[model samples]
Target: MAHFRQFAFKQFGYFDFYHNLPNQLAQQDYKSFVKIVFLKAGGHVVVDFQEYQLEQDALFFINAGQYYRFDTSCIGTLLYYNRDFYCVEIHDKEVACDGILFHNVYEIPVIFMEPATSDIMQGILREIKIELAQEDSGLEEMLRILLKQLIIRATRIWKHTHQVDNEDIRQEVEFSRTFSQLVEWHYTRFHTVAEYAELLHITPKALNKRITRYSQTTPNEVIKSRIMLEAKRLLAHTPLSVKEIGYKLGYDDSSYFIRLFTKQAGASPQFFRQQYQQA
Candidate 1:
């Protein structure tokens, strides 16, 4: 395995590049430092356990520690670099993508793109390619800025695609981003919408409204979904028993957790674990 403690980048000019990918790239999980993809062709992808089907030109953003894979061979430009290369978390206030574009579960991973937008993205990557070819002293810094520009463009699209037309745009995006972080912190300890509402210092109605505006789901639904995503990840990757997994998820009664997993995943915990492990 290659440990990218410093930096790395690549441009897959054609589907031929897929031949170089190892089988584990598709079957096992890995934490990507940062990955940005612009696909001229269409295909499907599975990030974690959630599957996404892409049928048009699209741009994708994957942050560190998220498991993902391309489902089929397609023409695209793929850029991946390590955290040591450009620490987004350290400069998060500057880029503002840590929550919204990177670790955002509320937002979709794939952004459908217009042809003109696609052309512009391609142009930026091409410029980055040129910079890579030249051994310029400031090459890394240049790539970082280009990466920032690409992320900012994608952020605009996410806001546009998910925002309600008449709302205060900044407030909506800000609230949702904050709320998502809150959910991550509190989901295990507090699972109710009202509990989260109190934490956000808002009424339950306001919380639900915010949740719906950004994620198209209620507060409780988002909370449960987050819990369910964790459950699936643990089952797929860990050796803990189903009862133990349930307990780890904060359920006192394992059966209740089993019901919740079955409801959200369309299969019992054991079945899901067996199927995924065997796959």
Candidate 2:
């Protein structure tokens, strides 16, 4: 059975806890807000054409504008909040999950919690549920604090998993985070490593060296992957032709775009789109 409790403050903010993912999301303007989904019962989730097995204690972060859906039969809790409630970019200093948890390019945005950590997170969710049920003058502030706590805790877990254990490692993570953030913001318009390196105020060689220190994928590969992912998303979901999609991704030459996509995705765009749709 699908069950949910939602708290919305007009256009300012919104929050909800869903026992089962509802069909209304298909109609909901999902691109307008950020989401955190925690699975208490094992299930499957699909985000941006990628499927993930959601075992107990697994948390998935879905950035705004991403394609998100799930097995509505599974038991889980979903949290939704818009920028007006608590902007991740503006408050990134407080929680530090803007790029690491949400828009991360090198890592999948899912966190697996140990049992103890899971308990702590569950407790925080309980507090949020209780707070959402109340009516008080400080309701907004309380919910924001709770949301920050959740993001902060998740960021810590992600850092630990990614081996951000020391100052040097932390710096590497920060640099990688910044690079990933830049790529996310400009992947549609910029496709070259040199361009991103210029944006980062570093030489291409230095940028490659630093990024490779944090991730096995080179900076160019990262950019390519992001572009390919968006291409795949459009090809799967939109009726746009291959040339249009290529042009949208900053490639004026359709054949070159096709070659690049085939090389990176291991399938031609037409084949990939046809196969994905048939699946």
Clashes of each: 0, 0
lDDT (10s digit) by residue, model 2, range 1-279: 222333474222333435446555664666777777777646777888777776556878887778876775556667777766776466765264465787788766888887898889888887887876677888778878888888888888888877888999888888888898899999989999999999989999999999898678999999999999899989988999999999999999999999999999999999999998898
Note the Cα lDDT for every prediction shown: 0.70, 0.79
Q: What's the C-alpha lDDT at position 72 in model 1?
A: 53
**With candidate 1 superimposed using the best TM-score fit, by how many Å does residue 223's alpha carbon deviate from the native?**
0.7
Writing each residue's lDDT as its tens digit, candidate 1 over 189-226 gives 88788988998899999888876864567778788888
- Residue 268 shift from truth in candidate 2, angstroms: 1.2
- Model 1 scores worst on lDDT over the 10 consecutive residues at 10-19
Candidate 1 CA-lDDT value = 0.70
Candidate that would win on TM-score: 2
Cα displacement (angstroms), candidate 2, residue 212, comes to 0.7
